[model samples]
Target chain A: MIRFDNVTKRYAGGHEGVSEICLEVDAGELVFLTGHSGAGKTTLLKLLALIERPTRGQVLLNGRNVGRLPARAIPEHRRGLGMVFQDHKLLPDRTVFENVSLPLIIAGLGRREIARRVRAALDQVGLLSRESSRPDALSTGEQQRVGIARAVVGRPRLLIADEPTGNLDPDLSLEIMMLFRRLNGVGVTMLIATHDLALVQELGGRRVILEGGRVSGEQD
Target chain B: MRLWLTRHVQNCLAAMGRLVQRPAGSLLTIAVIGIALALPAGLNVLVRNGEVLAGGWESARDFSVYLKPGEELAQAATLAKSLSANSNVDDVEIISAEAALADFQQSGSFEGALTGLDNNPLPHTLVVRPRPEAPASELAELARELGKDTSVDQVRLDTEWVERLNAILEFVRRGIWLAAGLLAIAVVVIVGNTIRLDIENRRAEIEVAKLLGATDAFVRRPFLYTGFWYGLGGGLFALVVVLVGLAVLGGPVARLSALYGASFQLQGLAGSGALTVLGGGLVAGLVGAWFAVSQHLTAIQPKI
Candidate 1:
């Protein structure tokens, strides 16, 4: 469902965030990006979300060239994909339910439908009991799960994450990884960026390795 | 359609909730907006009151034509008859020189001073009251024409005070409009700055919202509602200020009018006037919020 043809993103001051990155992942396929810090993993994901544009070459999503999406169309492009962050990105002031329901609210879903879908997503993430609790009250792992619940509440077919397990302990990280595997079992495509090679092997997915802002290797 | 309404309702409530959460800042911003809005509204109401007070005396369109000394009472009588025949002239009362002297001498000190005179020096005077419906220019033209007559030495309009008062009122009215326009800009700036600070404080929330597939409009809805509330609140507060001012001044104004030989009631804002002040505040608030969000929202992309 995704393709990048030699995409290059060069920041100002001649620093390359990502360069000459040609990649592809088939629909419903789960792929892990393995790299150290500043290896351009986040930049690659950002290109897909149109958060940052490629300085050269084409980036295609499904069959459409999305590298040059007009400013007005960026939101619609993003709405089709679920995104999770390492920081959880939950509003501390709001209830966990409100955090998860944000995407549906943006999509203009009815209030009842929002409640139903939010409950279902929360149930999936094992956060069903903490819906009314604010993010600060939830454990770090629970907060990450809340983020995952939010990402999936819209029922988007594609999901992307930038180091989703970066902040959790190994036990919690394994639980979150299993959660991703469980989601993949049901036909959701995912591109996850991470630095844990052993866990990448444990998850048993195709791993694309990045080094010095370029894709260095691929292993199945 | 229902979903749209529900979403908007939620957004408005959320905006209000945010404002309520930060009571001190919100109240300060609102107080500034209220005072800004009240300045122009209060001034406009005062101008209305001035117009009402001025209304009493502007209609005094009377004048006196003093005939030349040595003019016979018969000549003055004939002059008054001709003036009365003019369509603009409502009525003219002829005061013979002998009658003028006797009326003047009846007043105490003036009689003592004029006892040395062998003959009455007061000239024959014609007190002319013009038609009430006569336009100002028409009345001035009639006075000029009367002064040109050889029988008349001077044509003195008693309503000159009214003209001077009208000029001062018009000037003040213009000044109020200029001040209102300036203060309108001030209101917009105040709101814009407040919204900008609000956006900065909620920067993380905005980044998260945008990352979660929220559009600019989706992210902006709350701020817009905040502005809407600010404007609506400011407008309401301005109405309060105006009413309070009217109440405080009402008694003194009535007494002042009484001293002037008239009983005047102070009129507060009419319905339309209140609406106008409210509407202006709403527009300014919305505009300020729009500019603030448009300029700053895009600058805050979720940095990877």
Candidate 2:
């Protein structure tokens, strides 16, 4: 469902962030992208999310070159993809339910559908009882789950999580990973970028490792 | 379609709810903006009143042909007849020296002096009222034509007062425009700065929304609504301020008019002026959001 052909992203001052990185993910497959800081993992996820353009390569999703899509069309393209972040970037001003309902709202879903989907997503994250609670009231792990619920509430074809468990304890990290595994079993293509080698090794999914701005290893 | 409407309505309500969450801050912001908008709105009302005051001058298109001492009544009568025959002259009133003296005596201030006079020194005058609303240039031309008649010693238009009043009105008109222009700039800056602060405070929310597949529009909708409410509240407050000012000044205005023995009403904003104020406020809010969105929204990215 996702492919990259010689994708190169060079930052300003001629710094190569991601150099000629080529990779592919089949439908409903789960992959872990393991890399240290500044190893092009974030850049690859950003490229697939259409947040940044590849400098000298094609990034395709659903067999279409998303790198070539016009800026105005980027929003529509993003509708098919879900993304979660390390910061647990839930809006503190919004209630947990509101944060989760945001993606459905963006997709122009009916209010009844948004409510139904948001309740279901919150239920999945074990946050149904905390729907009316603001993000400020939630713990870090709970906030991150809110972010995850928001990402999946739109029922996107692909889900990308960037350091999804970075701030969590081992137990919470494992639980989050288990949530992703369950989601993948339900046919959502998943790509997780993380520093937790032990967890990825334990899960035994396809692995793509990055080093010096290039994909150094791939294994299944 | 119905779904989209429902979501947008919810979004708008959600936006309004967020604004209400900080009620004190919102009220203070609205007060600041209202003060800015009220100055221009108040000045607009004065400008409209000035127009009405000038409307009388617009219609007072008349000239008086005053005869010299020793000029015979026959000569004044002939001149009056000739002036009345002119197409530009709407009507002429012949004021003989005897009749002029009688008018002077009727005024109490000059009654004692008139009683002691041996003979009336007042000259025979032909009061000429011109056709409806003559331009200044046309009146000047008519005066020149009347001055050429030897039977008349001078043609006194009494337009000097009109000219001075027009100059003052012109100054006030230009002053209103300057005030309105400066206030508009102030409005934009006020709203722009407010929106900038909001963007800063909600930076995390914006990034979160972007990660959740929320487009620029979806993220911007609430901020835009915030600006709009600010403007709407400010505009309504401004209108109230103007009305209150008019009410406070109304007594003095009425008293002055009574002293002058003339009827005058202080004019307030009518249809177009009110609409302009409301629309201008909305536009200012929208433009302010535009500046903030263009500057800050692009800096946020969906990240690792």
User: What lDDT score is found at residue A54 in candidate 1?
Assistant: 93
For residue A157, what is the lDDT in candidate 2? 88
TM-score of each: 0.89, 0.87
Chain B TM-score, candidates in order: 0.79, 0.83
Which candidate comes out best when scored by DockQ?
Answer: 1
Error of 2 at A8 (Å): 2.8
lDDT of 2 by residue, B194-279 (tens): 88899888887777667656778888888888788888878887888888999998899989989988788899888787777888
Best by lDDT: 1
DockQ of each: 0.68, 0.59
Would you give me the overall lDDT of model 1? 0.89
Q: Which stretches in model 1 have alpha-carbon errors above 4 Å?
A: B65-138, B150-154
TM-score of chain A, every prediction, order shown: 0.98, 0.98
TM-score of 1: 0.89
Per-residue accuracy of model 1 over B1-304 as CA lDDT, tens digit each: 8778878898899888888988998888888998999998998888888788777664476788999999888998898888889898889999888888888888766977789898888999998887766666888988898889988899988777777777788899899889989998998899989999999999998998887778999999899999998988888889999999999999999899889889888989999999999998999999889889999999999865
RMSD of each: 3.9, 3.5
